[model samples]
Target: MKIHNPFRTALVATLGVGLGILMITSIQTLSTVILYIGTALFLSLGLDPVVTMLERRGLPRWAAVLITILAVLSIFAAVVLIVLPVLIEQISELVDQITPLVQNGEQTIESLKGWMTETFPNLAVDDVFAYVTDWMAKEDWQNNVAGWTETIGQGVLVIGGAVLAGLFGAFIVLVLTIYLTASTPSLKRSAYQLVPASKRERFIDIADQITDSVGHYVMGQVSLGVINGILSAIFLSIINAPFTAVLAVIAFFFSLIPLVGTLTGSTIIVLACLLPGVGSPATALAAAIYYLIYMQVEAYFLAPRIMSRAVSVPGAVVVIAALSGGALLGLLGALIAIPVAASILIIYRQVLIPRMDQR
Candidate 1:
């Protein structure tokens, strides 16, 4: 007689659901790991050429790695030394000035309102002022300030941890870079062997193109960001803008985000300048106009020249990639969008373009 397997079925069903959940959790964790590893690997790949050149001059792999790591660390240290003190000072100043700034802004608005009332006698200036003062005095305002302070404190701690992790990760990447660079040819051959003999050559070719495109794009963007930062810093210093160092650093990071980034940076700098009484509204307006013109030149001339030499991605594709990446992943996605787009473009050219041509 055949017995019903109700207990076995229930056990199997429960185990299956448990395993599915575990698998999903594992995949999420794995994805995070892969993202971190991929970032390090890409950096390693970009630095590999330098390692190769040194190795060609008879330097041992270990020595090359040490030198590369030292150079990176030294540059990082120098930047921190040059910029950190200024940033800290600016931040402290900003915090101290916040209350006074708010009071000044309130006064400015009130003065404007009074003028308007005198010009147009029917206007309710007193009512407007009362509303503004009430808004400022609200419980919500205090809550917001308290919340902001807590968030800032937490952010500082997180940043400290992230910096430590980044330093450790950099060391790991340096070692891996040296090893990968030294064995790149062998690695290529091994990778090619994994493909069927008929497809090996094509696969290798596509891989090489992708690597070159992505590496060049990354390097070019970094170069452009550095240039923009230096130029911005010079301009800010010449103009005697408050927080010039902080604003320049902000410009540099934002410049990594492509089209809208520079505009955002410029607006921020202009607003900060307005607060410090360094410029009248008209002067701020003039600076903003200058920034717009400069951005146009940079976009049309500087960007195209640099990007064309680095990667052959189309303008339309870059815009779309930036918008989509920004929408999906905020600033991080925007920063990597161009390289990601270039990689996709490489895949399309290598894989799909030929297939379409055949058809």
Candidate 2:
């Protein structure tokens, strides 16, 4: 006899599918809200120590929150004011230089062909140049330009919408952060009351440890990115590379991605150098090689030393975490991978290891 309840089964299936659809829709519609909430929580944790310090100095919680937010906004505004125009100019120059750079590259190829034909008498320079020029001319640059323009126009609309949504979400998170920070003690007390009396202290300790771990990781990552940006700018300047500032900024932003970011940044820098006519092919090759070596050194020496202090997870664990995180959540997964791994390690150390030892 079939004992299945058809109504119950249908309800369960419908609920599951509905929940999946809701999640997908939320990712698209409320993405800005998610981003804001995450960012605010991260920032709130980092600023907590400062807030506590201010409280000890006799300032109210609201005053501390106001001070922190104003300080952050002021610094952000300063950066935009100082850097935005220069970045815009550099980008415009880079775009304007592209067509001329391509023409020069074609000319360079033709010159090399001529030399090859002269050195080896049987070589056909005419056919080679003809083929090269034809290929270059057939690049459909106009179509590409038109397509890029269309894409940019669409991107602007999407970005504008996102920005508006982000602003709204940010307002909400800011309000929530102020309230949460002010009521943190009461919130903790309430949370602890929910737990069994025996485990209450242990739960609080675990929660605090997790908070500290995440806070340190965020601060460390930001610090590392800044250092990388400054070092990149200095190196690019020494090499007399065009768009040094722009490349530095790009490097800083991309360096947020774990292992692969440096390589990506270096590739862009090398390609930019190649276009500028300042570096010969040999020089470009040397630059790429130099960057690869630098990346290796940074990965092996700099990253471990910097990140070890922030998150105590081992190298092997970090690699596995990064890979798993990337697979799971793409960029966001990778960004928080180390911290997530550290949390797991913390849990294992505090709970599992202790239990195992006792047994």
Candidate 3:
């Protein structure tokens, strides 16, 4: 052990550093592809339970996997087809409405100034509005606001090369998901071969539990999102809300974030009703009432039933995991955070706790 040469040790350390640098650079360069691969893997794990259920119900594994993929794609297609047209129309309508909205805002500000002048004669609050009104009335201000408003996040929606690249990335993810899901058994077999012989059976059991937990969590989240979207769509349509489909689609994404997401999803709808001076203030009030009732229904009834089958994490842990993951990796990070926390808890309980008890 003491026969190490200084030159040899130095060369090895230098090579290790060089290799690490190379790996980091390569990962950065191919980050997009890597992200797609990770997404596909996540989807595969999430959907694996459904595939297994189908297999247990007498369908062949391949047939089960195919059916699951088809079901997923069908849902995706339906969302796109149903929501895309409405979203486009809503964007156009929103742009057209902006000028009137701005004008209404100016009127509201003037009205507020008048009210302040009457009620608070001693206060200089009215002067604040006067100064703001003068600044907002400038031609440059109007054009600048209007110019950005007209564009309306249009760059991302445009059918350009950038959009096509996004489509390509999606296609890759979709293909990988299907392939990986179908080959799950093979992957498991190969993975088991890598485990130490004595622990292989135990490892498989733990792995299965983890995978099942992941699957349950994913399905539960998706179920919650779909329910939120459908309910939102129905309510918005019933109320004749401005962008029913667009808001519903938005709800679907927001609902994927746990707990606070419902509030956020509904807040956007409420703000659209209230802030867009084109609409009645009552619409916003109605939105707030509806969401309050719905949040209660979700917390006491829906979430309990839906999330029960998934690995349970403490409420405090859930919030911390979501925040930490979100800070690190944005939406995807937040989405996976709870399940990851659950897995850690599982390992601690089954592995660490037992070992500690024995000691």
TM-score of 2: 0.72
Per-model CA lDDT versus the true structure: 0.75, 0.76, 0.84
On residues 245-267, what C-alpha lDDT tens digit does candidate 1 reach at each position? 88889878878777677888888
Ranking by TM-score: 3, 1, 2
- Model 3 Cα RMSD, Å? 4.2
CA lDDT for candidate 3: 0.84
RMSD of 2: 5.3
Candidate 2 residue-wise lDDT, 157-217, digit = tens: 9999999986787678777676666666677689879999899899989978877777667
TM-score for all predictions?
A: 0.76, 0.72, 0.85
* Displacement of the residue 157 alpha carbon in candidate 2, Å: 4.5
Residue pairs of candidate 2 with colliding backbone atoms? none
Give the clashing residue pairs of candidate 1, or none: none
Segments in model 2 whose C-alpha atoms lie over 4 Å from true places: 1-32, 52-60, 99-187, 276-309, 323-330, 356-359
The model with the greatest lDDT is 3
